[model samples]
Target chain A: MNMRCTKARRYLSQAMDEQLPPAVTRQLDEHLDACRECRDFREDLALGRRLLGATEPSLSGNFDWRLQLKLNQALQKAAGETAYPWLEEKPRGRGWAGNFTTAAAFGLAAVLALAMFIGPQGRVMPDDAGRYAGFETSRQVAGGVSDRLPLNRGALAPLSAPRGIQRSVSGSFGLGDFSPNAAFVLDSGWSGNHLKDLATIQELKLRNQRLNNQLYQYQQQISILRRQLDRPDSNGLDLGR
Target chain B: MNPSRDEHRHGSPSAARFDLVETRDEDLIVMVQDGNRKAFDELAARYKNRLFSFILRMVKEPVLAEELTQETLIRVYIHAGKYREIAKFSTWVFTIATNLVRNKMRQRSRRPQLLSLNPAPADDEIPLDPADPVADPSEEIQRRELALVINEATAAIPEKYRIPFLLREVEQLSYEEIQQVTGLKLGTVRSRINRARNRFRQLIKPLLKDETLLAELEMIEARVAEQKDNPS
Candidate 1:
């Protein structure tokens, strides 16, 4: 076979789909006329195409209805999800149950908040006083070391305790008397704890600032290294290595 | 107001309101995006048979083909809003259908026994017209046998070629459109189709040597010669 035969066979396939240019068509026709092998190849390909085309299957009768039903269901499902995203979060038939669960959760939260704010005495002070009373009672019973008066009563009562009683209570509880000097001492202790916390926080902040500065320096070094590596001279360095 | 009822009350045809049948597939898809159920149904009805035929040929199982066709249309409906006007709507839909067929083929390949190389003849072959009288019973039998050989040969073609071949031959898609559907380059599509044709010729060569086919070829050649002489 000649080169025309090769070109003609390629044109044969293209011609089946009417994809060949007119110039190529003329050349293919001439080649087919002169070449028996190319002509037979063309004819066989044509016959195969025709048979395949003839076998094109018709769709079954119920195809449209079946497809439409499925498509409608899918569209409806998509629509439901779009309308309410929470519907998708719950399984089918559990939509209302989901809402009910949410409502119950909010109701429980509100009830807890109301109980914390408004105790049985209808005042917030009673709740705070009761908590302090529980703590003092636990400490007194557990230790049984001091014959001190209950601090809860003294703390909640009007500031009308006699000075002698206050002094005795302060000695028994190992606390200084409620005087300006005593207040200054307590303030110093409280400030000491607060200052220690502040110092630790400041130390952490300083360390974080140092780390950020180091990170910035490393990043700058990386950028410089990247620029050097990107240069063509880096190739020479590698070759020398 | 109920639009159909209002149209009837005004003594106007319902089709005059929208004229969905005359609308293009892309416009129909746009309408579907705008929540038009009728438009979606129109698109589905238009492509149902063609899509089913393409999938059926690829998978060679009617039930699976039907399922795949339904899934493909459902995907189009769900993703109607994502359709861009740059590509033809038919190309996009066929891409979905082709992908589904490819996935099913992949799944079937996992269980090789289920992947029959030669499936039964498609269920929906166009029945031969009974009104046309046969010249002879023997000739008719030979024609049917020839058809059987053709079907078997087509089924035996490799999936890579068979898809483009059927898309070109039966569905009448252009090379570029076939490329879009199958995601193969234009050159690959053409080469695969050519290889498919050659493979089919090789498989059906024995049948081609039969007397009936030779006679048919002779008649075709004779007609061509007569046409050349007459120049009608």
Candidate 2:
């Protein structure tokens, strides 16, 4: 066989696959007809294809059943992870800490509101009769004394004085007296509405603190569940097996 | 005639209103990407036999082939969203199976002892042409023996050539499709398949001395020549 025979042999294989151009097929056919060696090679190639084609294998009967089980397990796991990506990683400790911080903030706000209520009450000054008398005499000496003063009686009233004295003094001064044990109070010269507004604000602060605590506990539970889901054994789907 | 058959044959008004639904593999795969489990099952059922045969021939072990086939299908199911329609679905699937075979071959090469056993039972099914009557039991036995010899000869071929050969002859993949699956250039795929055929011919030459086999070869050559002449 010459070099042309070798080339023709390659063309023969391509011809079987329907890959050869018409020109090459004609050249190969001409070579095969003239060369006995190339004809034998062509025969061998055809025989090999026939034998290989006949040997295609088939799977056993139970193949699909077994594969289906494994596939279902894998798909289910994939779906679960897709639905909750947090299950793939550890729930960050920062998330739970953030919730705790928010709760702490609410508590701080409540404390600040309580302080606003109690801080001014501790500094309450007793209504001294001598002080009032001195103040009246000074006013008279300085200038002609007015019939009334513009002081806030509710916040500055002397609790130590009798009710009658307190009433008489406040009435003469044209100021409204309020209870010393009032839950919320503003500075003197403010209206009664101001005190009511402060009390409403303190009530809202307490409610906000309660809601924040509830939210913090719920977040903590979610973090715990996320951590559990991240564990390999938690879902009872042993991936390694 | 049955009422549905009469309706179908006569092209009834209701039948004309609905188009026939013939889902292609790409459409089924798109459905899979959309999280349709039934579509996934359909895809798996469609490719299981072809994939198992290809992987089995590559690995030469039934159990490993079955495992690899399942792994390939599972990978497809999980990564359905990654598939692009630029390539044929078969090309993509065969590429995955081929990569897995390469990995298994590499692992086997590392541990020679592990490769010593091939416990899977040999495929004993005969490929008797249904059109031909079995006139003699001896002839059937001869065909089976010839098939076994051919299987051994194929297994003896170099892995580089054997893969392209199987992809072409067994799987009936086009040269371009084989190129995509193997990541080889067009010229390389052509040459590898040619060399594989040459090698297979040399290996099986001794077995072809039988008169019956030679006659079969002649018939095959004549048929091939006819096909060439007709160019169909």
Candidate 3:
């Protein structure tokens, strides 16, 4: 295609989204009117967009109910976690009982997990707990090491003004607004030791690089001297090294 | 797609700040930050389907999509206070959704997954819209086949292009919004979308060119139009 056709086609997608400025849009319309190829390109892209958008699989009708259940569970779990931080710790401690306890904690937490809400008295919603009294007893399905590791508590300390911090399911690294616990976060090793370890690692990395550079300089000097000594025209001065 | 409807039909008694339905998402989120849990419910109601649909297209599994949508919404709820007015609420929400989708996709990639030709859909799936053009039986059958082809084309688009492309074509987000969502430059977003569109166009070119299908589709639309006009 010629430059004009290329430029017009470049703007075709933006035009489809109605994203182009009015002036650019007018110019694009002019191009499309004059050019059959650009016109066809726009039509084809529009058809594609229409076809893809047609297959929208809608959310279930009872979506809100399901979400409410999940939210209640989250609130209850948050409360349970605050009461027992060790339960929230990583599963580095191995063995049958360790695994079972953690798993049971999760399963029980899942089943007995109160679907709680804040009532007018600022009390946990006891009614939901009764409604979903028989909660799912599914085992804590941890996705290997990453799932087991606790979130970096220190990274979460600054934003403690709201509620306590809760990690999103898959967003394990992300720290968000939640229950209030700034005091605990400040004293935790997650920030201090983690920072110290990182600094140590970085320093080591830099020192290693410096040593390698010094060694390279020594090796270069040795190589130059050896070359001079090997040459028949070399003066005995090369041997003084 | 303007296809999503808020699932919360009954409004809650709380959310005393303003009319949750009438308020902008940004304002609603501010109320959420201000300790109104109902405001978050309103936000979740507004976003659940849209997020589910967007994630489903990426992950290609309904259950996983539902889980991710819930997780993303929960993050939005729990983290409402942390969210600043620096970005659009939709942009921020999609960013969280995108993260979950990427994480799930990464985890799924580790193990080989077998694709079932006909997977059972979740129980609560909303019924198909009656106004859908492919409502007739003959059109329905043809459309199913077409849908399979289109789905494959969608899955085939590379990950980087896929999100931006879907956000554009499916979510109908503006280029600027998409740039914010994907953390891509404006020009980069446009070019990637262009590449994706070009690739999809190429893959589905034969289907579009199938004159018989086109003619049949045209006939179906004509018949539907006639029915609408006559109402008998």
Each model's iRMS: 22.2, 14.6, 27.3
Model 3 DockQ class: incorrect
Name the TM-score of candidate 2: 0.55
- The best candidate in terms of DockQ: 2
lDDT of each candidate versus the true structure: 0.65, 0.66, 0.66
lDDT per residue, candidate 3, B1-232, as tens digits? 1111121211222321235687788877765664457668889988887898788878876667787898999888878888898988999999999988998888878966666755666555432334444357776667556666777888888999999999988888889999999889999999999889988888778778777766755654565467669764
TM-score of 1: 0.55
Candidate 2: share of reference interface contacts reproduced: 0.37
TM-scores of chain B, in order? 0.68, 0.70, 0.73
- Compared with the true structure, what per-residue lDDT tens digits does model 2 show for residues B1-232? 1223233233345533422234567766765664555667888888898888788777876677888998999888888989988998888888988999899999988976543473544553211234224224664455456556666788788999999989998889999999999989999999999988888888888866678776654554454466459755
Q: What range of 10 consecutive residues in model 3 chain B has the weakest lDDT sum?
A: B1-10
Docking tier of model 2: it is incorrect
TM per candidate comes to: 0.55, 0.55, 0.56
Ranking by DockQ: 2, 1, 3
lDDT of 2 by residue, A1-241 (tens): 2338668877888888888888777777777779998888877787677776655555666677677788889966765555445457655677878889889999998777666534553444444442223222222211231222223443334333444332222111111253243332222221224575466456545544544555556765764554443332354233476
Q: Where in model 1 is the C-alpha error above 4 Å?
A: A1-4, A79-241, B1-18, B113-149, B211-232
Residue lDDT tens for model 3, A100-151: 8889899876544232111111321223323211111111223311222222
RMSD of each: 23.3, 19.9, 28.5
What DockQ do you compute for every candidate structure? 0.11, 0.16, 0.11
lDDT of 1: 0.65
